[model samples]
Target: MANDTGREAVKTVPETAGEDQQVQERIRKQIASELNLPQAKVKTTVTLLDEGNTIPFIARYRKEMTGELDENELRSIEERLQYLRSLEDRKKEVLRLIDEQGKLTADLKASIEKAGKLQEVEDLYRPYRQKRKTRASVAKERGLEPLAGWILSQPRRGSVLEEAAKYVNAAKEVPTAEDAVQGAMDILAESIADDPKVRAWVRRHTQDHGIVVTAAKNKEQESVYEMYYEYSEPVKRLPPHRTLAINRGEREDVLKVNLDVPADKIHEFIARQYIRGDSAAKETLQAVIADAYKRLIAPAVEREVRGLLTEQAEEHAIRIFAENLRNLLLQPPVKGKVALGVDPAYRTGCKLAVVDETGKLLEIAVTYPTPPNNKVAEAKAKFRQLIDKYRVELIVIGNGTASRETEQFVADLLKELGRPELQYIIVSEAGASVYSASKLAQGEFPDLDVAERSAISIARRMQDPLAELVKIDPKSIGVGQYQHDVTQKRLEESLGAVVESAVNHVGVDLNTASPSLLGYVAGVNGTIAKNIVAYREENGKFTDRKQLLKVPRLGAKAYEQCVGFLRISGGKNPLDGTPIHPESYGVVDSLFQELRLEREQLGTAQLKARLQEQQPEELAPQLGVGVPTLRDILDSLQRPGRDPREELPPPIFRTDVLKLEDLAPGMELHGTVRNVIDFGAFVDIGIKNDGLVHISQLSDRYVKHPMDVVSVGDTVTVWVLGVDEKKGRVSLTMKKP
Candidate 1:
């Protein structure tokens, strides 16, 4: 091998930590087993992460350190590491608290220590925890704990009344034998409820045998939850989307959701655990078991199971949202000569803005092309003036209110001009309003109103979706189903990672990136990003990556983490424009020398030919670099400052508009995927509303999810399935006509 290639990722880890070495080792081994990664790699990745290495940086620049773990794998490791560490911390806290109360036992400590989930640890700690004025605590105060224990022992030879009589004391508020026995039974029942083993068994039984039942709160009050007016489904088979739907309905008070589990099975299991053969206390224990199930155990387990279900649903929803957002943000940027953006509205006239080649706002104008005003001629005249003046090659219309009307008007106007080279594409304006209303937008275009600013955003989205979309909150992007319904914190976290990954994947142009885009780059916070922009503004464009070290609050660590992702075109060192890290410049220099090539030959046909002749595997050893790094270096050198997103299919530009009425069964039409959900993908086929291609109609073969067949921003050839003009819905099919 010519370099330390991809195949030679280091498989050994050196110990270095101030935390518990044993616990750290345990976490490393556990994560390794769980993710099926080599333990050495997991340990090394964890150490790098602990040293504050960002996932993107570690993934891209430290392939040898991580044994070639990608961003996804590294993220998984970080998540699991945090969870396991939290679990460890809680285990110590629980043990300390139990020992302070003088109730800790060897077996109990072992159980809690061995618990895998936070829930399990909490369960094991439940019995020793202090209670708030419960019947059991009251019984213990009345000196009936001994009686409860006696009953639990199931002494067949002893008389129940005699034992109860001994516990009776008027001074302690137990005046009768029956009252004494009842208080004792309360103690016994509470003990049964608090037992972790008993709780685990009951939880498992409920999950296996339970049914989720939902019923209407008021049948006469119509809602989208009408289908759930009287519905029941087995708990084990409930899908994530339905779980979220049911939870939302319940929260809105439109439906009452409950779990129905087999009580007889639970009671029998408890009876077998607590009762001895032919015990005199059998009947009394049976009553206690039933009471425990109904009043204490059942409700708690139901809530726990519901919470688990919601958590799973939330994770699933966040995963889907992340994928959809990733695709939407990674859409291939369309480089038009000069582009026009139109924010369409009915009562308000359509707001339009035109941008120059580099996304500079050239002009802003408005025309009432749709409804109420119906000023088509005026709109056309204004657009013609802007188009001819700017030499606009592409028109981007926002798919919002009155969008179809605007599109139709533009189609007719383009035909009247007979400019065959000009075309139009509809861009999703989901978060344009949010962005325009934000302080960031105000800062960017303080002179314009919200509508005009939104129009400009629409145009820039087609030019560079990632840069523009980063300004808005990911929740407002409207790419996922039930985004608003899922856990906001988790969704935001996942979407943030997606944006970060996309931004880092494409690499940011150091001189031109806005603070919003730069902020998403690994190791760059909002302040640091703002400082970078301000530095560029004050010092002029960055001439090399080394200038980043001079930015305020940007230390050596941050520079190391983020500099590789920051590309400087026409920099002093040509390698600065590539994704190749500064640390590996020596290796790259060695490679260039060995190939008899010069930096001037980068991205030339000569360089490509030379790089094609040598194998990274054969050259990695001699170059003293990892094969993965070498391959990436070769690719980056071949196309320095390249945007990976540009390699993907460009937006399908439309020269004509199609109405819902124009679509018929089996009419083959090309479209772009607007959004993806559990049920299907919504495709924009140049219409008022996006058409749905349900999962069943997505392919000739089985598709577990619509994403498996198509993604947001995917250009697909679809056929019309049917139309419901009354509902203004167009059903589409991805299957061949």
Candidate 2:
């Protein structure tokens, strides 16, 4: 490898080759077993990841090396690899800590080495961990450890009281035989609690059989969590959404939560383990076992169970959020259409923005079409003038305050204009306000108010959801299930990964992409993204992928990671617009030469048919490329500059709006799914409230989860199941009524 200054840098393999090889093998085996993939594939993927290859890059460009593993599989392998490495590091630290204390037994060391999770390793090290003074430590200091050990042995010949009498020493705070017995019991209790196997058994038992019970702190107070006020469910069967809701309710002091474990069953299990003989010490030992459970083990185990539940819940929530964000971002963009965006308001006025086909702002206005002012005639006239002036083909109304009224107004206005081509869509305004108040939005529209900027954002989002939505924080997009309840750092990481995967999957236009969009490319960070944009401003639009090398802070590795995901049309090379990496250009050139086809015919149907006729295995060796790489190159050539999202169903645009009062039982209507949750999906049916389609109502057969049948941006036809005008709720069903 050569450095940036063009000097050859010496690369030396590490001297710890044997250890490195062993670690690599272990990681490969573990990942292969966990992901149910072949060992060779896991090995190659791990090697690439260890070599600092990005997930998207490895998945897209190194297909043969990884046996054609996709991004999701690679990401899973990457995440598990990091976790296992951390686990190994913790294991080493634990062994060293135990050795320093002269307590590293062979069995203990073996157990630590075999531990799969950090929690298990920590459990093994609990006895060796340094501690603050507790009843057990204090009792040990009083020299009652020997008595405790004798009690643990369950001596048949010795009387428990007589044994306890020997430890009574006033100088060490053991004044009476009873006091000495209590101290010995305390020591025994702590020992039982500290035993790794004992703790593990108890934790497993509680988690498998415990019931999570909740009660309302103030039942009369009306809140969204009323359904959970008297909730009780088995810990093992608790759903992630319920867990999050219970946690939030508890946090708000609106509910009292408890883990109810069977004490008698736990006592029986402990007694069976320790109380072996019918000696006087048996009763003492039994009493101590109960103390161990009630005083120490139960509390610790309860906390562990709760933590496990929360962790599982958070993982599920994050997964749902990532899935929703992916679907939402990948929604088909309404391209090549002039759009008019409306940010609806009541007392103020509806803010409007008109953008050309390329999302360039052409006009901005505020009209009093709703509420107090109610200048319907004047507002319609102004909107008509803007529509005629910009030749607006579509209208995007933000689904916020007064949204339904504004939609009705627009529907009426479109009818008055007598233009059948003009249609309107109620786009989700989630995070639009946040984007408007952001520094990026200020830079883009310094003269506009927050509402006006929001209107423009709405317009552009319809034009290209991925490009416009990337500007706002993903969590603010409102496509998640209890997103705020999860760990923010974890949620951010998962959502960021989702965004990056989606952005890379649908390659970005190098010339037109915003810094926010480019920042999500495989290896491009915010600074490098900004540098690229600045470079474009200072120089000119990137004519070739190689121009990325000249951008500040964008080194060879970063370019290697991001180049394939950034496309340029009419650039130096015809393959620049496709997903063909620069490193594979040689093979592509060979392919083109062998086929006797010009670069300009890359995306033609004839070229696709010709390429389809050639077998990859036969042509790969001649082109000096792997079969997988050759196949990918052929596919890219067949569909140059293809947007993967263009295949999804387009957003439903409405020519007329329906009011809540107009909905009747068994009335069939088309709706756009707004959000999918565990139990149901919320669908926008052109009303004030999005109707709910319960999991049971999603299909004729049983539906395990709403996401199984619907996603965030899916368009589905449904029939009204019921309606409550007083509470503003609409119940809809997808199954046959």
Candidate 3:
């Protein structure tokens, strides 16, 4: 609480535009309700970073204080707090500026204080703000202010210019009736632009209704902006990927992007704020206001609104990327076996690689199969020999060019051979090519061609998705929604965290983990991961988790954070294979003594059943540990050497892949949901293009979001209501048939 960073230390200070203590109380209560924290414990003085409250630490412990908040909720709270604090700072700065201009009235002060949002505060301060030289300045220079005010007075039904000529016959400017009116209109336009309330109203309306325009520059200007030449779409409808692409295009001078709102719609509000008389001069005032809107306010508002829209778009894109990365990392691994991968191509034939159980490539080959120039019979003979010679149990086929044709060939061969013991998996080859050509991939497969390496990668993907995926750049994974549009740093950080958390949760097998897989473990990196693997190979199997200390550059702090998450299966102590941290090994030992059983007597399945009967709260006091820790210990004890990823539903598999033409309306079938978008989710029913399950049709009841019920890779039951193969689109519903 002391001056830790040379900043003022305060307690429960509510600094915001809203002076009403009631508003602050309501928001505080909302936070309390969401976090499940008591009102008293939810004091404003409590910083998220207060000594005992790191995000992960508070989320894991202090469940009562935070109402059982998970890591996601905790992160949301942190973000919201930062945003609210920024809004408060901006409000204070705006108030100070208005007061400095000496135009701060009691009414204005009250308006600013009662403002519920940042936009409202900005509106009230607009009239007093400093700006660049504009049309109003030019009109004032021409000595037209007197004539403009006279028009607003609306003197009964005479030519306003005739009246203005008498007072505005200045030698400085406005020599003719037309010139006088033009000068007056300029002043009125500037005044309408200055009106604070009008600006606020227009801003809100624009946000709700604005649509950005993306277009290539004119043909004559094609040399300047070529990339955006064919672009056209509503801003609201533009996906994350397109938004990023267009933004990058504009940034690099390849496109012209403009954000627009209905000028007529915005002008109506300005007219209401400024035009208020019923005479010829009143008509003149309206005309001037219209001009002002065209010449000044519209352009400025467009720029401001466009900036805000871009920011919102970027944030949404970043969040989507983060979510996809999390799910991908948490996907289940097949685990523990070597695989043979095939990267198929036409001219170069299909590249093949045989990898050992540890995923080290032992051999590589090329075969002509299902190609522009087919050698189907010869290719089949060669493949059959390789399968037998290498003792391969699983065959991985990359879902790439000529894949379906290759699949047909493989299926025919399998039926003829009739070996039910052998299985084959179709792997998504989304980022295989990208990884094979990357510097890291080159270093790993130095002696092999990129295509051959890609084949090996496809095989390994089936064996362990998370482990193999970590080696490739996540951006190229193809599961992301508008991935290219998100902020690069935020996308990387979030994905990296997801990978780390998933790796630690599953607890890697120290003896066999590759550097890529081990790098994602908590408190471990490429160098340390490689060192551990090398040391294990030199010294033989790890007898105890404590032996990790022998690895070079791995310190005590690293071991403490990581050892609990790394399980050594088939090790000396049964507890070592469980998630129970070594620090709590003493408590575990005591629990065994109290239960009148030896360590050797405990079996995973039996212990799980016993713990359900004897709950943790009843055991916490006896064990002399916190109830939270006791609960974690009990959960871990039951699932010794558990792979967390294996808990999720398995990926949907296809047999004799069907086309859209094969389906009928109201036909109920199991399908895998491939991707989720704002409009709805796309389900792959083994058709050419995935079918859309519109948000409205996602549930029988009102469904607000597709994600509420479905996620990418979910095996769901969907009814195909319509299919338009010609249009390459399909419609599906989640309703029961």
Best by TM-score: 1
* Alpha-carbon TM-score of each model against the true structure: 0.97, 0.96, 0.76
lDDT (CA) per prediction = 0.89, 0.89, 0.70
Worst 10 residues of 2 by lDDT: 1-10
RMSD of each predicted structure:
4.3, 3.5, 7.0
The model with the greater lDDT, 2 or 3, is: 2
| Model 2 lDDT per residue over 1-737, tens place | 00122111111111223455676678679889989999999888777766667788888999888889998998898788878887887898999999999999999999998898999999999999999999999999999999889888887797878888998999999999899899999998998899898999899999899999999999999998999889899999999989999999999999999999988888888888888859769889889989999999998998899999999999999998899999999999999999999999999899999999889999999999899999999998999899888889999999999998999899998888888999999999999999999998998889998999999999999999999999999999999989999999889878888888889999999998888898888878877888889999999989989999999888888888889999999998899999999999888888989999888887789998998899998999998899999988888998888899999988888999888899999999998999998889999988888999999899998888888899988999999999999999999999877
**Candidate 1, residue 218: lDDT:** 96
* Candidate 3 lDDT, 1-737, residue by residue in tens: 00111011111223444455564565456556766666555542234333223344345435556656666766666555545555656777888888887888888887876775677777777777786787667778888888888887777778886876764555766677777777777777777777777776776776667666777655457453465676566555666545666777777666788766777866667767666756777777767767776777778777777666666767766666666666666666666655668887888888888887767777888888776768988888877888788777677888788766666666677776677756665667889999899877887888888898899889888777877887887778777776666667677756665566556656777767777777766556567777888898899988789899999967775565566666787788888888787888899888877776567755655666776666678888888887777888777776666777788887554334465678888988777776676668878676555689998889988776677888776779999888787897889999876
Instruction: Give the runs in model 2 whose Cα sits over 4 Å from its true position.
Output: 1-20
| Model 3 steric clash total | 3
How do all the candidates rank in terms of TM-score, highest first?
Answer: 1, 2, 3
Task: Output the worst ten-in-a-row residue range by lDDT, candidate 1.
Answer: 1-10
